[model samples]
Target: MLDREPYADLPDLPRFDLTSEDVTDGGPLARAQLSGIMGAGGDDVSPQLSWSGAPEGTKSYVVTVFDPDAPTPSGFWHWCLSNIPAGVTSLERGAASDPPAGAVRHRNDGGTDEYIGAAPPPGHGTHRYIVCVTAVDVEELEVGPDDSPATVNFQLFFHGLGRALLTGTHEEQ
Candidate 1:
């Protein structure tokens, strides 16, 4: 495993509010977001997300779904969406299956523009999915569709005005 900074240790500005009617923080993830692994039936749908209370100077938003407990040195990114209009504050469930207009879908850790959903390797234990909505200072991140999650994170880190997270957990049966 690779050594990396714990997410909480990162520099963060003031907090905002992010919520989801489909996902409960610290609660089980909805099956719709589960992956079809080990014969488990799943749709790999992104959960409905909503946010509010961004600080002044917010220009756009970035939304992502990351798995911190995956059996990986760098964790895993299930979603990496950039250039969401600042006027936009919510994403309907399954939106990842078909990205909304003006939403720039960046390459996730899975190397695709689609949400791969939760699919921990067998015996990998429970995993926490941290879904984040970042308020960015720029209306559009200077990035391409091929940009990796790490690249996007770097950009957001510096340009981020504030952020909010709606976390949920899941484990294989």
Candidate 2:
């Protein structure tokens, strides 16, 4: 596996506290977070996430799950939920199927607007799934269900006030 830090090139912004009940930084993801759709033999469920201490002026939030170690040039995006109201700080497991009102679930690299879970190719080594919660300055990100994860990130580059990250790793034999 290539040793790379995905966010190394991102603009340094204020950081907030992020926690997850079903995932942890530097830890292996549970089977529930593995991709059933991709034949990973696990339940495809979004992890429970919570965050706090967003910077002032934050009006909304964006949650994304990305894997920088995928065998693709641009990596892979497993989930991207945007335009969440700032008042909402936590999501229960499987929230991808029942996002908060006004939040838009953007299509991931898999062409689906929901969490796809992790399914690194067998023998590709461990992959890091980075879960990020970004505090935005607007109530809505102006992106729709048709927008791709890259598009949502483009908007976030301009409007993000702070961010929090939690990572989980997975590997196939």
On lDDT, the leading prediction is: 2
Count of backbone collisions in candidate 2: 0
Candidate 2 CA-lDDT value: 0.93
Residue range 20-117, candidate 2, lDDT tens digits = 99998999999999999998888889999999999999999999999999988889999999999999999999999999998999888877888998
Off by over 4 Å in 2: none
Clashing pairs in 2: none
For residue 71, model 2's alpha carbon misses the true position, in angstroms, by 0.5
| Per-residue lDDT value at 17 in model 2 | 99
Clashing pairs in 1: none
lDDT of model 2 at position 30: 96
